[model samples]
Target: MKLIDLNRDGEIGANCHYIQIGSLNLVIDSGLHPKKAGRRAAPDFGPIRGVHLDLIIITHCHLDHIGSLPVLLREHPEAPVVMSTSSRMLVERMLHNSANVMVRQKEEANIPEYPLFTHEEIDRIAKRLTGIPFGQAKRIQGGKDDITIILHPAGHVAGAAGVEIHHKRRQIFLTGDVLFEDQRTLPGAKFPAGRFDTLVMETTRGITARGSEKTRLIEVNRLIDSINDTIQRGGSYLIPVFALGRQQEILSIIHDARKFRRLVDCPIFAAGLGMDLADYFDEISRKTKHVRFNRGIIKELQIKPTPRKLNPGEDPQQNGLYIISSGMMVERTPSYTLASGLVGHARNTIGFVGYCDPDTPGGELLASKPGDQFLFKACNVKTKIKARVERFDLSGHADREELLEFAVQADPRVIVLTHGENEARAWFAGQLAEKLPKTKLIDPVPLQTYQV
Candidate 1:
């Protein structure tokens, strides 16, 4: 098989891959860079420009994975897109939200090439996107070659999947942003127990070592304690989350805490696309049994929408829990704006519960020490970091050791790493070399082709 990493800048931005097995041509994931804008954010499809794509496989609905789907479909009009049934249900909503965000950015950030694809284009392309049931093998043909594709549950989010492809006597698996440990709202991954010819995996948390004592339950309790302490101290708690998965997961977790009477009696505020996605998740849970979310959680928790007109560098004084979007706390986002005000107050707390890119505002804040001056450039606010900033080990991605063990057990002939920073990938490269000495490890340079 031959493969090319289509991501332009590499380092976990714009995830796109093109590969060929026998006579088949396939592309897996067409994602936009979370920190990049305009055309540069999209994958460099120049290598596959004239190559007729036989299939486009999407692993999930996160913007970083599916944000560029419409753009890719616009270019390859005939290639059919396939994903797990749950992802199919969520993809359009996620893409529509992306288009809406791009439209807003076009006006606010003055990007003329924003709204890369319109709503109409999404509607037109929706007909070509099909959702296949998990564990069901679908035979796809290209030229004289045919391969059977099966999607396995990847427990990162509600609709995430790990792709398994069988071509002739060879088997290949691609772990797309996976988490093997279960969470409050979802179960852990259920990958097949077997060997494979090739393994492509995500090294998202490879550089971060997990402490033996910091289990999920312990982290959950610590988070609850932190929130209770913040609220008791008359300060608000902010958990910036990814709307698609992390928001829902955090809500479910908070709901559990409240049900057990472990949480303090404080008003909970949450708003944004995540609240709307709750309804979608509820429907999915009822229909597919793949997710476990209920829209009634909002009503029971008495969740309130975030106030629309929030002043920068001024505390809202809600003294409640605020769960908002832009997990990375990107500039101009609600989390970033609220963080600006909260960071200036010593009583408040900002707790992170998911992965943050180092270049993003969230990661920068995490790297800073207390009393350091932090800047909210988008809002033109600068203040001393008096607030308590904490991070919990509740990330959606799998742990480094867990991922390493999975790859080592697979015992594949070749291993390809994707969706991580240089340091993270380097750690995995070093560990895999030491553990699986003979396995060919290929970290493809962006836009370069390699035969495996």
Candidate 2:
């Protein structure tokens, strides 16, 4: 079996992998980088552009994992796309939102190729999608070989899965952003307890061991305390969250906190694609029993949608709790716009609930001290950091120790790490070497093929 990293950055951004097993050629994911723009954001598809891929599997609907899917489908229209049923619904909305964002960027940023793929193109790609329920093994003909693919629950998002491939006598497992611990909305993964020859895993949180010491319950309580304190001070709170998993998880946390009286009743506002996804989460949870979220919570809590644009002097919603998207607070996003209106006021609080790219606006804001002056290039505005800013390690990824434990249990002869930066990978490499000295750990060089 040969594996190649298609992403230019070996780290988290633009995650994609090409796997060649005997006669079978498959692309794991085709994603867009959050930090890059235009073609640069997409994975390096040039290497496998003309190759005949037998199958394409998307593990989840996160933009980093599925963003450039339409572009890839346009290039390889014959390949069948496979993902969870929830991902199917979520990806469609995500791609449409992506296209709209690109169009807006074209008008505002003057990028000629901003809208890399159109809604029409996305529609065409959607036709090829095949949603498979978890735990079912499907066999497909790969040239002269029969390949069996099984998707196990990943517990990362509403419908995330870890893919298992069986070819002949060999088995390979590709963990696409897995989480072993349960979130408020989703349960933990239940992967088959067995060994594989090759284990390709993500090392997204390898550099941070902090999560290992803190439980999700602890983090959730801390978040509730922060919100309560902010609201009690006659301040509003803003949570910039990822549209898919984090938004739902945080909403559940807030809802439960209010029910227990840990948090005061306040007007809850949400905007962006996450609101649309909440309906899907509700449907899937009811149908599949995959998530703990209820659509009724949205209505019961009276979550209102924030206007697309808030006026400059619109007095910080007066003790409202705003859950907005563009988790990284990307420029022009609803979170960024709302934050711009709220940050200048000392009475408001901007809370970060998940991972933020260090280079993004959200990360920058987290690093800034109170009373610091920061410039938001997207809105071409500068504001004082009078609003309280706090970040909780409410990460969806499994803790480093959990990953180490999983890897040890998998007991693969060859372990290849991806989806983490150099520091993170290096840390994992050191840990794995000490614990499993006999195993070979490989950090993939971008575009380079490795035979296992």
Candidate 3:
């Protein structure tokens, strides 16, 4: 079996990895890098040039993991893209949103640009998707060989899964993006019964050390306390959040705090698609009260607000708190607009909830020093640094301890860590090498191919 590196660098996008076992070709996670300053960057597709992939498996709906799929489908035309039902729903939303951005960027720039794919390509890929649930095994025919692939709960996102491939006498496991007992949304990853020959895992948060889940609630409440203190002093609280995971987690936690009056009663505005998604999640929890669904507490927090929705020319003095989406403050994004409006205002605080690329506006906010000033383009508001800027490790990704625990449990003959920067990847690899002396720890090199 041969493993090919697609996008060895994590977070930047264009992560395309391929696995070849005899006649069967398995392509995993064809994705694109986020656009910087309105320009879309391409992922490294060098390893897939000479061969045609028979099957494509996506782990989740993050644009970086599935963004390149439509183009790949447009080019391949015959390969089946497989994912979970929740993932399909998320993919549709994410793809359409991304396409809209590309179109808008093109029109605004007046530059001749190629959209990742047409709506036709999206429709075709949607049709080609085989929505497989967790714990099911699918066999793909490769003209000369048969390959069995299994999807196991990854707990990263609603439909994220850890993929396992069984071919001949060998087994390979690929963890797309994992939530190892963080308990943000889904349950922790389910460990497969048996061992595997090789393991491919993503290390998006390898550099960060996450606190215990028990402390997560404490930290969240602490942040809320600070926000409350600011607001009680006649300040506006602005929390820039990721539209999906982090936003939901924060809502659930704050809702619990408010129920017992631990936190102040303020308007928790769920703006953008994040609000809709949160509502959908609450509905899902009501239907399926499974512990796997962390909706029990959230269900109680779903009480109707007093209709505080805002519009153009609306007064902002009425609400005390605002939670908005697309965490990264990019131009034209709702969170960006809001942050630009709130920044440099002494009475307003903007708290970042998730990862932010350095070039984006959100990243800039994260990089702000304690006393530095920030510019708000939308409102022409110059906010002072009086509104506190703080970050809690309320992340979905596994930390060092979690990574070590996972490596020990999922012990394989060889381990390859991807989706992290150089320092983080190296630290993880070194840890594995020291702890698991018998296992061969591998760090992915850009476009390199290794036989497993």
Query: If scored against the real structure, what TM-score would every candidate get?
Result: 0.99, 0.97, 0.88
Candidate 1: residue 233 lDDT (0-100): 100
lDDT of each: 0.93, 0.87, 0.70
TM-score for candidate 3: 0.88
Span of ten consecutive residues with least summed lDDT in model 3: 306-315
| Residue-by-residue lDDT tens digits, candidate 3, 119-205 | 666866778887786787899888799988888877766677788888888888888888766564567777585577888887777
RMSD of 3: 3.6
Order of the predicted models by lDDT, top scorer first? 1, 2, 3
TM-score ranking of the models: 1, 2, 3
For lDDT, the strongest prediction is 1
What is the model-wide C-alpha lDDT for candidate 2? 0.87
Report the lDDT tens digits of candidate 2 across residue range 117-192: 9999888777899998998899988778889999999998988989999999999998899888888899998788
**Count of clashing residue pairs in every prediction:** 0, 0, 6
Q: Report residue 167 deviation for candidate 1 (angstroms).
A: 0.7
